[model samples]
Target: MKNNWADAMRKNVHHLAGSLGNLLVESFHYLALFAIGGITAWAAVMAFLGMMEKGNITVDDILLLFIYLELGAMVGIYFKTNHMPVRFLIYVAITALTRLLISDVSHHGPADLGVVYLSGAILLLAFAILVVRYASSRFPSAKVPDPDATVKGALTEEKGET
Candidate 1:
């Protein structure tokens, strides 16, 4: 009887420790995501203000704003779904490369070889986005349930709804 009691106590302690560890990890995950989302929002606001102060928004400035928008959207989607949209990052890369290409061509003329390389990189990223989209569509994974859905389900059950 004493041995059984000791085993039960051990198991309970192990379970408690596991639960505590999971709670800590989940707390940290949420905190870090919130910090990232907040920073992205703040940086985007600052960049917009800078453009307003300049009073002349160039193509480069517009492209930079697009990059910021993609970053903010990526963060918001990740926060909502707990999944990173790889395509958004690819979109960001393509936009950044296009901006760089424009800047390089304007400063160095059309004879510069860097334009070709940047264009090639942008093309590759566009292809990668296509491939990712194809694979996701071909073999979609299970969707993550919405947090509110569970609460709504419980409420429905309590109300004796089918």
Candidate 2:
């Protein structure tokens, strides 16, 4: 009986520790999400102000805005669905590279331009691969349905509804 009691206590402690760890991890995840959202907002506001001061939004400015938009979308989607699509990041990288190429065109010669173009092409290929991976079920995904949907479906089944 004493040994059984000790084992029960140990199991309870282990369960409590696991619960606490999960809580801590969830708290940190939300904190990081809020930080990302705040920084994205700050960047968007700064970009808008810069464009206002310049009196004209240049292509670089537009591309920067696109980057900000993609970042914001990434954050929002993660917050809602808890899934981060790799394609969004690839799109952001492509946009950033294109912006860099456009802004540095006057500073770079033919060879440098070729290198930049090649880099952009590589990014495009990565984006294509991600698209195909998502399009085909043969590739594994980290995405899962919302927990709320699972709960609702269970409740509906309990009620004898489809």
lDDT of 2: 0.82
Against the true structure, whose lDDT is highest? 1
The lDDT of model 1 is 0.88
lDDT of all predictions: 0.88, 0.82
TM-score of each: 0.82, 0.74
Error of 1 at 139 (Å): 2.2
* Number of the predicted model whose TM-score against the real structure is largest: 1
lDDT of 1 by residue, 1-162 (tens): 999999989988986887789789889989998898888889889989999999988898889989989998998898887798999999999999999988887777664677778888999999999999999999898888764577579779989996
Model 2 poorest ten-residue lDDT run: 106-115
How many backbone overlaps does candidate 1 show? 0
lDDT value, residue 39 of candidate 1: 88
Which clashing pairs does model 1 show? Answer: none
Model 2 misplaced regions, further than 4 Å: 106-112, 115-136, 142-162
Worst 10 residues of 1 by lDDT: 106-115
